[model samples]
Target: MAGSSLMKSRFESFICDANESVAIQLVCSDNELDNEPHNHAIKEFNPEFSHQLFGDNESIFGYSDLRVKLYYSSAKLNCFLSIGFTDKVTKDETNGIEADDVVDTIRQKLSLKLCSSMDEFRSLLSKESQFIPYGKLMDSFSIDWKTDEKQTKRHFEIYSADILVPGFDAYHQRMQTFLWWLIDAASYIDADDERWQYFVVYEKRSPNGLSNGHLHSDAHNTYCFVGYATVYRYYAYPQRIRPRISQFLVLPPFQKCGLGTRLLHTIYDFYVTDTAVFDITVEDPSDNFTRVRDFVDSKNCQKLNAFSVDKLKLGWNEDMATEAQTRLKINKRQARRVYEILRFRCTDRSNADEYKAFRLGVKQRLNAPNQKQILDYQKLEKLKKFPEQELAFIRQTTIPALEVRLDLLDKQYKELEEEYQHIVERLAES
Candidate 1:
């Protein structure tokens, strides 16, 4: 449900491409361009016409057909906009359209000056800008990453729907558009959904702070948008709520800086304290997300008394199930999975006796569904007794299949362990 306040602004119709595949990227800042005496605009919107356009690292990749790049300033004064189209799409054979026509269409939509030169672009920005600042944030925190034995701190903030209300806020809508470029399959959600929550990470810096450093302003609480996640609350049985993480993204600039982990842990902290929360879940998590979640969950589950090395060896008991569900709000199935992982970590695979016990334990669970089939085969066929049927099953189906399954499971465990190790290493560093 969109609120009454959602209205079109100056940059509303900037995207001119009819193809949904065309990506629009924005690099914006809130800092006033007071020092800059001139504005900047795109001289050439053609990508392949020039060698290595937008510099080496800034080039857009993976799109064979088309791409639209936008660069603009969101300062209090002197707003500037630039538009560019990739060369592959400019070819009539490839795109079935004229590149110049597409660029013209975008220019018409943005209603800004076109620049053939840097000086001209800068001159256009010298004029007064109509940039409206994004709204203030509610809660914030800082996470630090170490570089060359030095710690660098990043500031992040959390926002609720009420704080960002009345649903149609300009920043909220702008962010939805911005997210579409970076997040695959990104779409706008109902801001009116009371169960939805948002978290944003920003690269904040004060006016006097170093370029891209933390801003020292108490008066202006708006931080430069870095990355964000959207979560929805689901009604669980027995008067509890399950918060399902929906879309998660950390911009390329802020990625690999350990902010994703911080953001996820922050969400967990938010829900874990709620009296009505049952457990947390994620919706159709990607491979990257699965790794992050597994790492976070394994760490959290390890602290529970029921998940200790000894308790884990005792197998998945009610204590493990009950404590994980009651205290950590983890579901029974997930709790059991976590228990197995922790137990595997404690096992010394080099020892035959210990390793055999571990394999037997896992195999018993793996073969559980086939137990009745083996019994039925023996009883109905009457060719052999229970022992003979079991032996035949083991030779024909069970052992061979178990070998393949175990190999796959071991590989998965090893991969998960590697991912978990990375998180733990970062946690220790941070």
Candidate 2:
């Protein structure tokens, strides 16, 4: 027992949280690449996940004060990975287990070319100006974050292009590596597939006239890659396509400035006019992305005649779905969701009758799967003795589970309301 305890204690000493140990930075530079006159790293953050490279435990067993510096040039997205540590637990002392080969693991997982020397990295950084954003500029906007010296309302531009764009596959490789660190369950896309499209966000150094959704050549302007999204064009039956957002990510330093919302709006603008597109959809969105999506969808739905105050009061109508589909290119499922969001936006919680009606309507949608389960059971009975059998089934089975589902339903409703309230708050600010 004493040996076992001592071994465990030694093992604990080596275990380092991979997420915390890894440091990522966006290195920004102007004409002076030889010497960054100031701190060259404009933005620095750690990974949201590391288990894919560091094993399921997300720990690296044998490093102290580990600093995995993975820096990328802001303009070109060129990568440089450097792993450093104050101490390493060698296998000789540990009695058997070897320390993880950090660089080897990251090289395998990220599939990025690592810089062998600082000179090589700076060589790539020197040529950063030659790197231009791929594809056509689709939209542009500015965000204002205050600094001690000035209001840093930086200019940003979003571009949409096919994966086939010359040199884009290479660019995508470096950009998609960010997904491994930030997006959960993230994986790379096959750029060779013609159906995949990319929309990228970049921060342009220029100050004004960004609202035009177009950028003219300004030698003075240096474009820095910010965030990006990937979309897949799935074939809808009988000649239409459904464009689903496969992945969306805004780098940590750039988030919470409405860049994501603007990015989504640009994506919508790209497809809404295309007759070939059936509807827009998202695949396995995380909670944060879902809220952003809901906000965009509800706001778009609000512009339609079907989602007017009176129409919304009427609640989830056929016209709402039709208008949302043909005009906005939103699918039925998302349209229904937008309807509920807009409905909840205008619902008067203070009035008992109005509130009860809204609650019951939402509950009906929430209970649909449970209702289907009951029907499924009924169907198994050969559809015989419908009224009596259903009553008996409800009494025997549902009566016990009803209390549980009711409690869940209330909880769900509360969550939904809170989410809607947040959307409404954003909407108001916009």
Candidate 3:
């Protein structure tokens, strides 16, 4: 009974749709309250538009005259009341009503068909209870892609110029931090899962860390070649990719910049070249079809199929079977299981873990040789320094402050050393 008030409030909020002309009111009264005779009112609004726009019936170019009947429907209002509570108010004492009696009276009058059960009518209201339409869900989770460069730089900068493939220690630290952030955000949304997973996009970077050269200077410049080791393993063969991309959005300031596009292109190049992958499959939130389509088109890619789970069993073909087998070879049975889990069942921690394990396995495979080469190169490069570049960077950028602090510390150390020597000499004389 305590929750009845909250339910009533929620029901009242549901009636506030502008398209539907409906309103509900509730009143309360004491047992001794004198009540007036109840009367319900119904009103219907007339349609403003006429059927003449479609032309008269049996009229060819309005030449033939024919009679037509067009009845346009409009919004209608209705009121009803419930059966009176005889225990609370006697038939002779109808002049005075209790709060329960009033509610019962309203509910009875509201019932137009006495033969129909109230239980059946109550079932109709259940349809309106706490449901989100598919269209609304799609609209809320749409992804927006940008083609501009200046915009992308505002959000994510090139933190590292060279490969800087995160070491295992660093990767573990970053992965832990990333998991914490994911848990924190998911908790806010009351999501069921506490685990988070992502696929790492490994590719070559340009010397300057710019994917595309100066936007204005090079219209037909030779764009950098960013090859993918195994596109299918990195980008495709994952279930969460679609929902993740849909809900994962870049800020407005990051749009129109080449960052998103470049990142995608890098992945695309990897799939196309290194992996020889012709088709890259992406699952996008239903709302992000436009963004996904645009990205596909920009990369000269084509949509192979709009995948759904039921089709896997009922409509499995030779081509799909072969592809599934290939995926199994690369990723084992886990890949197929992930597809099945994501397609038929609700996304949960198990699916996330499966996806994460598959990804880590793929990355480990690719990085085996690449990781060794990177570590060896970094070790050798650390010994060499470009004095000119270092001086330029310190003078042109904010590094001068750091240099100034070093100079002050050097001066203070020298003065302290001199004072210590004088104190030592004084002690010797004494």
Candidate 3 weakest ten by summed lDDT: 69-78
In candidate 2 the C-alpha lDDT for residue 395 amounts to 52
lDDT of 1 by residue, 1-430 (tens): 2432232221122223333323332223322233453222112122211212222233332233444444432232122333344433334332343334445544543344445553554554433133323434545666675556466565566544433454324445445444434544455678667677776555444434322245554554333455667788899887988888888876554567667777787777767779898877787777777667766777888899888888877777879878887787777777766776676677787999886776667656655655666675556457554576566765576334656656866675566556645655644553
Please, what are the lDDT tens digits per residue for candidate 3 over residues 56-147? Answer: 22111111111121110000011122332112223333334222222332233222222133343334323322211111110001122234
- Candidate topping lDDT: 2
What TM-score does candidate 2 get on C-alpha atoms? 0.91
Question: Per-residue lDDT for 418 in model 2?
Answer: 90
Q: Which is the winner by TM-score between candidate 1 and candidate 3? A: 1
TM-score of each: 0.63, 0.91, 0.21
lDDT of 2 by residue, 54-153 (tens): 8788888888788888888887787778888888887788887788888888888989887787678787876765667899999977777554555555
Clashing residue pairs in candidate 2 (N, C-alpha, C atoms within 3 angstroms): none
